[model samples]
Target: MSTETPAVRVTDLTVAYGELPVLWDIDMDVPAGKLMAIMGPNGAGKTTLIKAILGLVPPAAGRVEIHGGLYRDQRHLVGYVPQRGSVDWDFPTTVLDVVMMGRYGALGWFKRPGKRERDQALTALDKVGMADFRARQISQLSGGQQQRVFLARALVQDAQVYFMDEPFQGVDARTELAIVDLLKELRTLGRTVIVVHHDLQTVRDYFDWITLLNVRRIAGGPVDEVFTSENLKLAYGGRVEFLQRQAPCDPPPDAPDLGSYPGRIRP
Candidate 1:
């Protein structure tokens, strides 16, 4: 085990909506400077887990700690990119205006952002390749552009830990590659990134650490150690067959063709 402190820790975490439990007892530790993916099938509480960690949803039990302290006490250290579907794209707001919201926490009550915040937001937009669209209305951007703007918002926070929810959901292939490269850059800068990802084929290619979640955490460790056929079977059950097609193994003589599994697990 690594002796270095974890960037994010969830212990005995449980969350429920009224009487229906969404997430069961869960414990996970994400190490610093690593790109981690939280993956599971639909209705597996992947989003709920992110919400709990960010304090957007109240956990019915357990606690979350950031660098060994409560999240509320270290809010400034964290940045969040919610699923794009959660926002109203038609809202009358400019791309730069949305990015500047990342600085609201630092601005505090009644204090408006000035030149410093604008400069920071612009730098963040440039990092995501969206600086040229700063004056454009958010509604005018494509799905991929919108995602990049959200990334810029998180970047402007200058946070040590970032939580992104399904950033590649509706993006083009080029956008996906760009986002992957940005994630790698963040890791290189010693920042920890946790993403809610749905694509199993890209898991091995994109992330070093992974947590297989299904209401509860099935496995959490280095991808090579935990992202095995057996662990995947435990998490996805019958759906494991779809993932087997992408596994790094020679096909058996009787194995079905990869093209047959057209359905993908979306969560």
Candidate 2:
């Protein structure tokens, strides 16, 4: 086992919506410099897990640590991209303005973002192929374009650990590829990235580590070890009962795939 400190750790974490539980006694360790995915079914608390680690939601029980420290003290080391649906897209903000918000943690309260911050934001936008749309109103962009902006925002943070909620949710195929490329780049740079994902088909291609969750954690580790037919069946329930081979994705009837999906779990 690797003795290095984890980039993110959750210990016996539990979260609730009033009396109803969202996550229960979850424990996970995301190693540094890896791309990890948190995945589960429709109401399985995937997003809730990330939110708890980022401290957006109060945990009813347990603790979370980032780089072996409290999240509040480690804020500068982290960046977050929330679900696009959770944002008020119609709000009056330009693409560049949205990206600049990432600089706020480093800029402190009284100081406004200056040319240096603007340049950083622009460069991050360029990295995501959205530089030309810098001045465009956020609401005018398509779903894919909006997601690109969100990625740029996170990139500009230059954080060592990034937490993203469904970055590929509504993106076009091209945007999905672009995001994947960027994530690969981040991993190469030795940054840790944690994402909440739904498409089981692409999990192997996009992530190095994965945590399978259905309210509580089912399994977590290197994708090859934990993302198995047995673990997937456990997390997804009857949705994968007919998976004859661990290598191909024969999604159950409820998952919107009428036929096979490519990039299935490879043996």
Question: Lowest lDDT 10-mer window, candidate 2?
Answer: 258-267
Residue-level lDDT of model 1, residues 63-104, one tens digit each, is 999987899998998999999999999999999999999999
Q: Return the number of clashes found in candidate 1.
A: 0
CA-lDDT, candidates in order: 0.89, 0.88
TM-score, one value per model = 0.92, 0.91
Flag regions of model 2 displaced more than 4 Å.
239-267
The TM-score of candidate 1 is 0.92
Candidate 2, residues 1-267: lDDT per residue as tens digits? 468889998999999999999999999999999999998877899888988988889999998899989999999999999999999999999999999999999999899999999999999999999999999999999999999999999999999999999999878889998999999999999999999987777777789999999998999999888887788888877545334343334455544543333233222
